[model samples]
Target chain A: MTNDASPNTQPTYYQEVERKGYSRRDFIGFVTMMTAFMGLEKSAIGQVAKALETKPRIPVIWLHFQECTCCSESFIRSSHPIVADILLDKISLDYSETLMAASGFQAEEAMKNTMTKYKGEYILCVEGSVPTGADGVYCMIGGKTSMQILEEAAAGAKAVIAWGSCASNGCVQSAKPNPTKATPIHKLLKANVPLIKVPGCPPIGEVMAGVIVHLVTFGKIPELDRVGRPKAFYSKRVHDSCYRRPFYDAGLFVETFDDENAKKGYCLYKVGCKGPSTYNACGVMKWNNGTSYPIQSGHPCIGCSEENYWDNGRLYERASAFAGFGIEANADTLGKVALAATGVAVAAHAVATNVRKKKLIFELEKEGKQSEQELKS
Target chain B: MANKYLHIHRLRRVYVWELPVRFYHWLNALVIIALIATGFYIANPLAIQSQHEASGQYTMGWIRYIHFAAAYLFFFNFLFRLYWGFVGNKYANWKQFLPISKKFFKEMWYVFRMDIMMLKGKEHMSIGHNAMAGFIYFLTFIAFLVQCLTGFGLYAPMSTWWLPKLFTWVPAVFGGDILTRQIHHWSMWFFILFAVIHVYLVFYHDYVEGRGEISSMGGGWKFIEEEVFERNHHQTPNPEN
Candidate 1:
């Protein structure tokens, strides 16, 4: 409902929130809350508050490709609806297929206006991978393939943000034998722009907010890992911060979903919880207003945040032996079989060897007796 | 001293495996078996129950501890063998592991035909490891090194020790802990295969040749025919050089 932010009356984040009926105290609370979510010290809250109150909001163009749109759902459902409202209202979000209410030509024109006005200055946020299979016929929007739209938009963006596992690592669509041949944003576009990957099945809403806050507050992307993920959220594995980690170190695990161990809140490692292998802030950040995550809800993490998770094998299977990569048996079963077969073969060989050696020994004794008798004669 | 049975003349015996080499061989065998067993339990732990507190029963924890301990033993023992190869007798020397000469290549070819192809069993005598066995052991050493790096790589994130921390970069290098773990698990199969073949061949040779092949590894001695011993004695001793 807010008017376009022109160069003259460009309001800061606080000014927009106040105009949207938020008190000054509410604005300060928001800044402090976001700072904590970003794993920053309390003192940084003042810095964030100052940044929001003084700096002009940046322009952002959100693009959707071949995806389920779960990322948008998660983003809008942050712990506080005000957080989502403030972020969207505070920024110059010119175009978003999921958020924009404008239809047809009007929406396209708005996106074109933003690209031309703020060329090489606005942020490009991509939510899914580009399906290059069949000339990317898999994902076409507004009579344009996702690939064409991405290159056109990315060409004038300052930095790109890969929103979720879909755009970051090609999620399920790029799994083995990928019919669509969906490629991730970074690989699909040769923009050579600095990419910040906020990867999760649907990333924690606060985390998405945190990245934006860091960029808006610092004028640069946060520190990233080798795979372009923020270190603050992905520095440690879920296992490291899991409430059941003590149970893991103690070797107590739930055998079955409804078993006694499961009732006792034991570790779900044996049941193929990908907590140990997956790197994400789910354990620390929690989901649904800091209420609970998948593990706490009696369900194992399917490693949705990780790359190629869909093709890694059955969700409930352990990483060590997931479908044995098509070998029906797991690593242990196959190893045991190999050992047993070798043992049987060794036994059979020993029996056959005994028979052959025994016959030769008897023949050698006969020859010795014959030679001795001949010598005596 | 009482009644003597008819006896045939057998050539004198010679020492091949030194005490240290024999010690390392059997120790390596024991450690490998332990590693394989413990490694299996660590990867696929049994569903152990504890009536009391979870801390009371450290079943999987102890299994992992045993695996790490055995892995360290295996690594150090291998290092010792490598050191011995440089200073020990000619048979255990480092040169034997390399195909540095024409004889080594010829011996390898002969073994490929005799053992693998089953074409012929023409005798090609060497007191120490045959060229093929030596080459295989060399490859096994490389596998051992890989196991050490990947194992510690997986352990690095869980431990505070400096040793494992040295390999902390390996998981990232391999893309993830799961892939590194799979590689570590697969290498165990290589050792398993090596052990089965190694034991079977020793038993087979001991039965067919009656040269005390199995006993030699235990007592550091082997028996050869008189003519064969004489020929080897009169021959030059430049095999190692």
Candidate 2:
């Protein structure tokens, strides 16, 4: 492998690719695949390929705070072999608490050394949220609060990437009545560095790699949505491109989790699937190398990619209703009100007609009585 | 004929609202009722039944058709009203809408004075619509314009060819489909509140002041002493010689 140890040595990422047993043809193929997955145009593939072949590997520091480390787990199990290897080795992943073999001060020393050596040049990847409620005592690693360590690391970083929903939006940790006051990385960091959020309970692995590749290749962050998510991935709702869209359109929904309707692969929307309102690429990208997403495995999406998936509602209860077109359950309230109003109008008209008829009959009877009285007189 | 002195208790036959204006008022009311009914249904479908039961039910489809058709009718009604504002009779013309002059200021003062005096049970009235009612009527017209614009803007995307481009500024001005839907939903509240207040004012004025305001919209004007009417109009009554 190309030794990136020397600060003066400019060994390109291509050298690392060659050392990893990937031929030129293999490197080109990886670039083509990345372009497709990243939703980049064919014209941009050459730029991506050239960057991979020439740009020096970027230095990255991955921090784990109050998290399950699922982001790391998902990253390593990416579909593309080169994605994991290239990101871990070629990208100079200097410090990760879960992946590093060092213990105690050794691990601490590695983190400090990287920050000092590559000051203002490294990327800071925060995996989870930092609790600030109680002077940041809720979560600690190696005698320092996760909040303290995060601020220290983020102080000299060029950019920050929140890897999961926990780090991006505080996830379950910051849901309603959050006791520990877990704050997202972006909110905790007061720096002017560019922040990119890849939010999901555990963001898709390929998406994680794609963010890094785009950063290295373009020398800038990808175009992001209003919420700082990459528009290329988070722009379309999961319902828009889901495989079970036909079932949703036909209104064939799964009433329960284990029902016959569910077994037939009908829409899980009625069973508390937040897919219709959530925007994520999971349905299209699929996890574990394009094998299957959560919905495909008979589990409705809990909308883990959204801001507060945990506190939004129950995972097993369908949304009451969404504000959109079509009759996707719970939209019949308006229909009922309309029908009731029509009935009331009809009843009102009927009463008015009856009253008019009674008035006419009474007048005729009074006229007859008056005529008889006049004749007798 | 009835006694001339007792004739003051009878109704008069003078045109005020005009046929075109009355037609506009009633048609708008009916269409708004239909729109709100179907709109609430389209917003959230509450009732559900088995496929067999739902199959025989054309309620949703028919409601949607009525709603959309009423929307088109409202559009044309508004168009005609706008045209008539410039070309209709003096009382129904564009001048009736503009309340920015010395005369309006004086009228506003008297209207406020009347409201203050009304606390002591002194009768306060006007031959035409009162200043506040005129202002509200103008506001209702503006509200109608907004409803038509937003409703059509939403409907355009469905047809996709011509109408969408015409009101493309709606989504851009409002933010997106989500925001537009919210505005359209909430706008219904304004119309509903206005309707309630309007009906209440009509009845309150008619019953309490004996103005026959409610019947004015149907058969036109109310009865008043000829001498008082002539004095208000700065005319000398020529008695039969």
Candidate 3:
């Protein structure tokens, strides 16, 4: 129905997936699922389907640098089996070091062709940080520095998407006294392209899909926060939608991993849940087809989405960074020490005042008696 | 000794602290203490293993409720003091807080030298707050306002109240919640430190000056020598006094 009206060279995402043996029914079901879970209206399913059926696939140049490649793993491990195929078809993914079968010359050639052909039209998806130390030799792919690769790739792109915490804000590599000096994408390359940060240790699989879907469907980046995270996903703290939030409000918390409270599904605040401070869709979107996230499995959020989360220290410490109790001593410890010191000072001062008062009273009595005797004399 | 001193000095009762000032002073003290207790709890709650449902306990909610309620009282009480400074007794005047006057600087220097530097026989005398104390209080007031802006700014996201919503721009102005919470939490310590010093200074002044300085806040009255009263009258003679 669409071949006559559509472009000749490129097949639509629907046609591409259909060629890969997926039924039109599977395509519509995927759209309907995306609409339901991606916080979109029922009408969005039709629009999403129409866009997939009609529009040409978006060209994506996925570049890897200094990362664990967990973002790529998470993206491919999306709950829906069809999402991978749909994603593969819809994104027209030119090159990814980890995902693609092509290697050596063919991989390099494909990336070069996409850069020259698509130029300003393709999306530049960055999955890791770039090490700027020693002329960016810390990370090299096929004898080319990540800095050079990123610059060449980012120089001609419509928008740059930082795929994970590593890409958005250098994960462990950029922690305190970073030897490699791995800097995030936004810092390394300063181009005239819109940048979106999907910042988690590895962002939720569907959220990645949602971002791509938003760009493909809307033809523009989704509404971004001040920090460039998509507002639709990063708008609320994980604690807001958490199941045990009522327990938090009520001050019931799991004292330890093996406690009765933990068994009872109490709030994980005391066990150092960073849910209140962390902004991510993990709670709402969940993981592995909404089966469970970290908190649901009784593990405290490590605040992997936040900048410098690794440097923040200890995922299981109770006090938030706001509480001033993460690294050394929490605020309670500091305040208790200060209060105890204040108490000791007050006690000491009281004793000193009492001693001084006793001396003054004694002298006053002695002077009074002496004055009385003198008056009598 | 009382008779002899009274006969020698012709001691007069000078009504320096007005009822409104005294009321505000004690209320502020009480509220600040309550805020500190609840604030620390809000920052980090005690691990009380109550044998009840989450809905039944409502412990953190109560702690937060007490915090927000006391914060409101502290805010309004501060506002009242600000208003009273404009139109209340001369001693409660905002002009006294500002060290703009040459006399203010002179008193501040004298107090600093005599009290802080432990200078003997420096002869520190003030029927009301000296410029040094007043200046510190002015700074404390500014800090209190910042606490309100930041506390409500953080609350704005959590609360449905229009009052807290008014301060929503504070985080945006200050960058975000991390800094705002730090400022808010740190200000509590400021008040605590101020309280300790304030109480100590009052006791110290009472002991050194041999005056009813401690009772002055409670009774709105201070006993001074007739000469000192006359000198003060000559300086700031309010008809009410």
Candidate 4:
């Protein structure tokens, strides 16, 4: 690993934020919000502020493989444009297909420069899965397979951040019957670097910023849950903080998308809201600068953040009918049929037992009467 | 008149199920029934519309509360039974449930033939659980463990308690929460099937064998024929037969 910039050579994050015309108050506010989002106590705000003022901008290589580029769209459209701009600039994003202005050989040259310049210091942020099907011909960028590109980029990274569900849990590309054999970064990366998964269809923009800011502030990855998701935003379920949870507690649910209960803002559990099971920051953080989330907009959560949510069941089903029980058999239906069959079996068995018992009793009485008659003779 | 012809003095009373075993039985039966009813309701709650304030109604909350409460009872009750399997009387010993010997399998086959296949075979009698019934109960205990794991695993996110947190690995092993919940719900059905057959056999055996089998669970005593008891009393009691 080689470092091109000395500690004194590069401008710190605070200096860059000031250079970008953000007032000192704006910088502190953004830092405070990010620190809170990372689940740090208010007392640690000064420590984070000091770290950001002293640390140089970390070099980052943002890669795009087989994806819809929605993560980039969401990132650039972050509700607070300054938050997006400062964080993106603070990380010194060297190359991104969707956002970078370079094209053709120039873009490849820039990526190569960062990979060699920073060596083990640069962070590798992958935004999509790597397709390995048919020798990775399904997705090719610049004549190299996604697997080939990912391996090269990850070989020298300090840490890896899987930006969206596609990069984290293989979102829709790796759904059942995945034609491309799309593999998430964790499974495909040969590097043993620390990996963080921010899994959502398109993760909330502020959360993405928060993850980056936490890394810049702490000089390491945030504490992660068992599945490697940052525990701050991925610990609690959407249902745990949902405003409509009272409706669920009261047993009031919207039966359909366009019903009176829907108008009344009832719970969406019946219409297949996976909020109770899915873990994400959508409920508390909301989207688009805390305006509203999908559940708030009267649409059921599709459990986009959870692994294998696509194969769980129909989007509108309350419970998932797992494989091997057959497509038509959910737990309740299977249970009902099994109970019905047990009832029939028990009834038939009872009849047989009674018949056998009566015949045996009759034989015993006949022997008793014959023994009495023989005693009389 | 037929009552006089049948000898009433041919049987001797034997203490079988201990007080703790009977207590565990009835408590377990009650808790399981509560869990199944409330569990199904939680999984598929019927629409209970309220024209009043949402805060005024707590139908689903109460049901969930009852379900979780019963689940705790079910878990601890199962643990108590597991402990009792080691310390309880011979009739309730853990070894009785394990099919460890050739004789155990032979008696299990005899029971299946007479009770299930309805073949006229030599009567299978025991002062305690028959081998076939005991082994099935053993399997049911395993199901109990699964239910506890999955139940707590699903509840872990809502809870910050350490006990439930310990079971977070359960869902991870099963893949995810949806699959974990599916298994938890499926175990409810297994208990349902177990209950139907268990109740049917208790009454069936009591009537056919002329022993107080059903009442034995209630009063902790069973009437064993004197000759059969005497023959087996000298040897280590083979509860299998």
lDDT score, candidate 3, position A24: 78
Q: Which 10-residue window of candidate 1 chain A scores lowest in summed lDDT?
A: A1-10
Error of 4 at A173 (Å): 2.1
In candidate 1, what are the lDDT values of residues A1-377, reduced to their tens digit?
A: 23355533567777778888888888887888789988999999999999988887778899999888888888888876557787763455778888888869988888888888778777899999999999989999888999999999999988899999999989988988889999999887777678999888899988988888898898889999877889989878888899988788788888889999999999998888888778899998899888999999988888888877776546776734535345466665677788888888777767765564555444446545656776999
Give the alpha carbon lDDT tens digit for every residue of A189-270 in model 4: 8888899998988998888888888888888999998888999999888999899999999999998889899999999999
Tell how far residue B225 is off in model 2, in angstroms.
9.4
What TM-scores do the predictions have? 0.86, 0.66, 0.84, 0.92
Native A-B interface contacts kept, per candidate? 0.35, 0.00, 0.30, 0.59
- Which segments of candidate 2 are over 4 A away from where they belong? A1-10, A23-26, A255-264, A313-377, B1-241
For model 1, the stretches where C-alpha displacement exceeds 4 angstroms are A1-9, A319-327, A344-377, B1-27, B76-105, B116-120, B160-163, B210-212, B215-241
Can you write out model 3's per-residue Cα lDDT over B95-144, one digit (the tens) per residue? 87888977777778777665665544434356777778889988998888
**Better-scoring candidate (lDDT), 1 or 3:** 1
Tell me the spans in candidate 4 whose CA falls farther than 4 Å from its real position.
A1-8, A89-91, A322-326, A356-358, A361-377, B1-9, B234-241
Better of 1 and 2 by lDDT: 1
* TM-score between candidate 3 and the true structure: 0.84
Question: For every candidate structure, what is the RMSD over all alpha carbons to the true structure, in angstroms?
Answer: 4.7, 9.0, 5.2, 3.6
Query: What's model 3's lDDT at B96?
Result: 78
Which stretch of 10 consecutive residues in model 2 chain A shows the poorest summed lDDT? A322-331
Superposed Cα deviation of residue B176, candidate 2 (Å): 12
Q: Lowest-lDDT window of 10 residues in candidate 1 chain B?
A: B1-10
Sorted by TM-score (best first), the order is 4, 1, 3, 2
